[model samples]
Target chain A: MTHLPYIAAAYALAVLVPAAYGLAAMRRLRLARTRLAALDPRPARRETRRETRR
Target chain B: MTAETSAAPGGFEMAPRAAMFRSVDALSSLATPAPPKAPGRSLHRFANPGRFLRLAGALQPWLTAGGLILTAAGLVWGLVVAPADWQQGDAVRIMYVHVPAAWLASAGYLGLAVCSVLSLVWRHPLADLAAAEIGPVGAAFTGICLATGSLWGKPMWGAWWVWDARLTSVLVLFFLYLGHIALIRAFDDPTRGYRAGAILALVGVVNLPIIKFSVDWWNTLHQPATISLTGAPSMYLGMLWPLALTALGYTLVFAALVTARTRAAVMERRIRALLMAAAAREDGAVQVAA
Candidate 1:
């Protein structure tokens, strides 16, 4: 059996899986940050709750 | 989950029904209710989200560059420079990618297990988030290992897959990753989901040692470990160098991934918290209007 196809399939899947995952993560992160900024513009405000809890 | 808030006029367009309650107007009062900053004397740094975000932002570029360069260099050396095995010919070249991915599948789970323990025992805020983010990456690497192993196997063993101990255990590892992902997102409350997922992760860890020892413990078609700390490696140096390079490259890639994903997870949690606070404020306004 020619090992060429097997080798190609293996490498291709390996690269594709990680690349796909990384891209999806980046997309999700971008959307999340946008929503967060809209909801609470000031990161400092969150620190207030921590202070009261302490 | 997407938090749908309208960007109408000056701010969100309150739902039509929300306008019926005069309390809805109170949302405007919340606009400037700032939280007091922590005192200057505090020494703890990393627990701060702002600090962690800044650190992640700074490190990401360097991590990306290093991971890409190492992976590229290793792939080139493995594909173009490494000699083929006498018995397997070019098929053995798959080892460079295959071995590193397999190692990562195991390593990533171990990391997940550690995060699970930390989350459960110490209630480390970052631990559950890290554990949650790691599931996908671990699953991906596990998938790669299985696919590559199958590919290599077809040529060598004359079959695409078998119920051999190593292969079967790794399959179980893949399912465990899937289970973690599904369980973590299964609940309406994220905290509950995290707790459930952490318990599942702890239980699933028994599979790790089994996956590692499968070849030694059982008579299997899978070969024994090529590299061992106890004695000299059986592989030739020509083959060893590429494997080493790819292993380092893959590890850096995994590190970069974990860092990036963890940062994203933190942001997601922040969004959830902020949304909940906003809802609570709205509820208080409604009560006053009533």
Candidate 2:
């Protein structure tokens, strides 16, 4: 634990940045899906069927 | 009917006119833009966004879950279970994060290069999106690598920053990532942006080998490779285990991130196309009314 702060900072960054980026991606996907569904529900329905079958 | 109104295919009389317009917009948008006729049939198979989206959707959850589990396990083992380095003491644990980030920085760029090839040579639709998505993620990993390396260097090397070959080359790599990210979004037309960025990515590939061999090529303060494909790792099994775990975790997570982002990019494009088609229909209706 001699360099605890450095260790902490590195780990925090390694985890947090990617996590944040992933969340943003997921959010964008969700928004896009919602818009796509509004425009036409067929693709979303197809996706749901595929998921259900899986 | 005007050209734009005619473009909206007939059907869906049961639905409202607005709904009919929306459906036509969506259908038109969903149609994949054909790539220039290319020789590689196998590569072209993945050019279809619908197929790629399906595959990505299936893989994303598994990748995310596995990555989180492995990364968490590796961090815990590195921090608590593994013995402290006798030379560097507790400071060596920084390698758990730093080394993986460093590896990802290089590996991610290699992926970008592949995307560049796919984009430039085959005109692969998915490749352009993948390249655009990969840049920012690659840049993030490189940034983490540099920050962690600096933290490690401050304590061990007595300098927070050094002009050593390995360090300098990696800094160059980081800047290359930044440059690619900026260049890809610099144009008014995205296709032009992708083309320019693809060229840059292809050019930047020269730095990868320099980065790989920098410590050996020059008398640098930075250490040489701890692990290589040709030889056994130069570390204890305890340390190696965590390193391996974290490295795989990082790789999986990187793939998942890129996949997710690309899917989002595809969706955004669809949304744009749909909006544009709808606008065209509206314009046509207005013209007809006038």
Q: Which candidate achieves the best lDDT against the true structure?
A: 2
Taking the tens digit of each residue's C-alpha lDDT, what string does model 2 give over B1-45?
123222332321111223212211221222245354533465676
Q: C-alpha displacement of B225 in model 1, angstroms?
A: 0.4
Q: What are the per-residue Cα lDDT tens digits for candidate 1 across B1-290?
A: 01222122112111211321111111111122223464332222244567666556566566667767777787778877988888998899889889889988887787788778767876666667778878888898899999999899999999989999999999999999999999999999878998999999899989988988899999999998876545566788787667666666676666667767887878887887888898999999999999
TM-score of each: 0.81, 0.86
Candidate 2's TM-score: 0.86
Pairs that collide, model 1? none
| Among all candidates shown, the one with the greatest TM-score | 2
Question: Where does model 1 sit among the CAPRI classes?
Answer: acceptable
lDDT tens string, model 1, A13-49?
A: 7677777876877777677766776777787345334
